[model samples]
Target: MQLLRSLLADRDWSQDAVLLSRLQQALLLLRDPAASLDEATWLLVADETAHYLDFRRLRTLEAQLRGCTQDEVRYTRADWQAARTAEAALASHLRHVRFSSYAPEPVPMFRIH
Candidate 1:
C-alpha cells in the first residue's frame, strides 16, 4: 500500500528493475525444493535487502501522508485495482528478464555411481 507507493515514487526505474529481478530469482528458488541451502540463504538475504529498501520508501510515504488530511489520503477501489495491476506487471516482467547465471530450465537430479 503506502510502502509500495513510496517505493514507486522514490526509486529510479533502474533500481526497481534490479530489485524486481532479484525478487524474481528468489521466487524461482523458493519454488524448487532441490535448490541448495546456500541458494535459499542468498535469496533470504536478497529479500531482506529489498525489505529494507521498501522500509525506507515507506518512511518517505509516511511523511507525505502526515502532511495530507484524512480525506486526501483516502483510497478507492480503483486505486487498489491499479496497485494490484502494477504489482502483477512488475512481477511478470521481472520473472521474464534473463540473468546471465540463471538457467532457463531446472537442472535434473542424477544418481552418482
Candidate 2:
C-alpha cells in the first residue's frame, strides 16, 4: 500500500505506462480470492481495490466537471465524500486484521462449580 501510494504521489509515475501496467497486474492478483495469500495480504488487497475503485469513480466525476451544473457539483462532491469514507473503512479493516494476526488467541478457563 505504501509503495503504491508513493508511486501514485509521483508525477512521473502517471507518465510511466510500464509502471501502470505492472500495477494493474498486481491489482489483479490482489483482487483474486484464489491467490492463496494470507489474511493480512488479502486485507491489504481489499483495501487497495477499494482505493482503486474510489479513484476511478472520482476521476470519472472530475472529467464531467467541465460543464457541470450546480446539482452536478453537489452530486460529484457527495460521491467523492463517499469514496473517502470507503477508503477510511478499508484502512480500518486492514489495520484490524493485521493487529489481530499478532494477538494471542484467547484460552478459555473453566473450573468445577
CA lDDT of each candidate? 0.53, 0.58
- Evaluated against the true structure, the overall lDDT of model 1 is 0.53
lDDT of 2 at 51: 54
lDDT of 1 by residue, 22-92 (tens): 55555556567897437655765455556546544444454486896423554433444455577789988
| 109 Cα displacement, candidate 1 (Å) | 84
lDDT of 2 by residue, 26-45 (tens): 65565677765567555655
By TM-score, who's the top model here? Answer: 2
Q: What is the lDDT of candidate 2?
A: 0.58
Question: What RMSD, rounded to one decimal, does every model reach?
Answer: 20.2, 14.6
